[model samples]
Target: MAKTVVQEFTKGLWAEIPPFRLVLGLCPTLAVTKSVDGGIGMGIATTFVLVCSNILISLLRNVIPKQVRIACFIVIIATFVTVVELLMQAFTYALFLQLGIFIPLIVVNCILLGRAEAFAFKNKLISSLADGLGIGIGYTLALAALAALREILGNGTFYNIPIFGPSFQPFTFMVQAPGAFICLGLMLAGMNMLGKK
Candidate 1:
């Protein structure tokens, strides 16, 4: 049982990473990754929602009727998303502004729904918790890596702190919408290559 739980937890880190492996949760992954701050903020908020919703869904799995399970799952996820949004608005208002609509859209993030239905709904509380945390952290790492790449190449900064000298030139395009797509594609391809080896 312990080994199984560990496997469940570790799988999210590599085997089922949301963006690279599962190709899930692309909206915020692409939109908010323009900066490390935005990426980390969005990642943490989504992580909170994922952990809370997963726990609740696992606890209520048996009670949720099969006919309306999907609706019930949404309600659970939306509740946590609202909590995260309000908390961010009160404490991290700047990041709140940065994330904007993406924060609210967490309710519909396929990762939450997918985990709720696929893992949490069928697992024990502890297993569900592990799964959520693992996946949440994995997602966070991915966003940070991508954001770091975009921020450094496009803005010539790391976490808004200048890293390069005056002689350095920023590739401004790396921070644009097109850059997000290209970067994601590159990362996905890299993951596949590594997977094969």
Candidate 2:
């Protein structure tokens, strides 16, 4: 039982990463990852929601009717997301502004819903928690990577710390929508290449 739980928990890192492997939450993955801070903030917010929703869903799995499961999960997720959104607004107002709609859209992040339906609905509490943590971290890491690339090239910084000297000219495209696509495509290609090796 312990071994099985470990395997389930570990699978989310690469086997079922929300963005790269499962391709679950792309909207915020692509939309708000223009800087490392933005991506990290989004990741943290999503993780909070995922962890809360997963635990609640697992605890109530036996009670929630199958027909209304999705609705129930959404309500649970929305509540947590609202909390994170409000917290960010009050404390990290700048980041809150940067994340904007993407923060509220956490309610729609397929990763949370997918886990609630696929894993939490059937798993034990400990197993469900592990799965949520693994997937949340994986999603966060992917966003951070994208954000790092964008920030370094577009803003000549990482997490707002200037890395490039005065001689370096920022690549304006890296901060744009097209740059997100480009960065994602390259990262996807890199992952595929690594898998082939």
Candidate 3:
């Protein structure tokens, strides 16, 4: 049982990592990754929603009618998203603004809904918790990594702290919209190559 729980958790890290392996949650993944702070912020918010909603949905899975399961999942997800938004607004208003619509949009993030319908709703509570944490952390890591690359190249900083010498010129293009797609494409290609091996 313990091994199974561990398996459920670890799978989200690499085997089914939302951004790279699964190619899920691209909206915020692309939009908010220009800086490490934005990436991490959005990731944590999504994680919070994912874990909370997963737990509630799992607890009520049997109670929900089959015909309305999808609707029920959305409602549950939206509730947690509102909580996250309010908390962020009160504490980290800047990040709250930085993340903006993406926070509320978490209600529609495929990772949450997909996990609800595919894993959480059918699984035991403990397994659902593990799945949520694993996936959430995986998503966080993906955002942080992508943000680090973009920030370091585009702004010559990591988390807004300078790393390169003053003489270094920032590659401004890396932080732009076109850069998001190119960088994501490159990362996807890399993941695919590694998967083949």
lDDT of 2 by residue, 1-197 (tens): 88877887778778887777777898899998999999999999998899888998999989999999899999999999999999998999999999999999999888899899999999889999898988888889999999999989999999999998999999999999999999998988888898788
State, as a TM-score between 0 and 1, how close model 2 is to the true structure: 0.96
* TM-score, cand. 1 vs. native: 0.99
Can you write out model 1's per-residue Cα lDDT over 1-197, one digit (the tens) per residue? 99988998899899999999999999999999999999999999988999999999999999999999999999999999999999999999999999999999999999999999999999999999999999999999999999999999999999999999999999999999999999999999999999999
Pairs that clash in candidate 3: none
List where candidate 3 sits over 4 angstroms from the true fold.
Answer: none
What's model 2's overall lDDT? 0.90
Q: Which ten residues in a row have the lowest lDDT in candidate 3?
A: 177-186
**Candidate 1 error regions (>4 Å):** none
Q: Model 1 has how many clashing residue pairs?
A: 0
Query: Which stretches of candidate 2 lie above 4 Å from their native place?
Result: none
Minimum summed lDDT over a 10-residue window in model 1 is located at 3-12
What local lDDT does model 3 show for residue 49? 91
- Quantify all predictions' global Cα lDDT against the true fold: 0.95, 0.90, 0.94
Alpha-carbon error at 50 in model 1, in Å? Answer: 0.5
Query: Between prediction 1 and prediction 3, which has the larger TM-score?
Result: 1
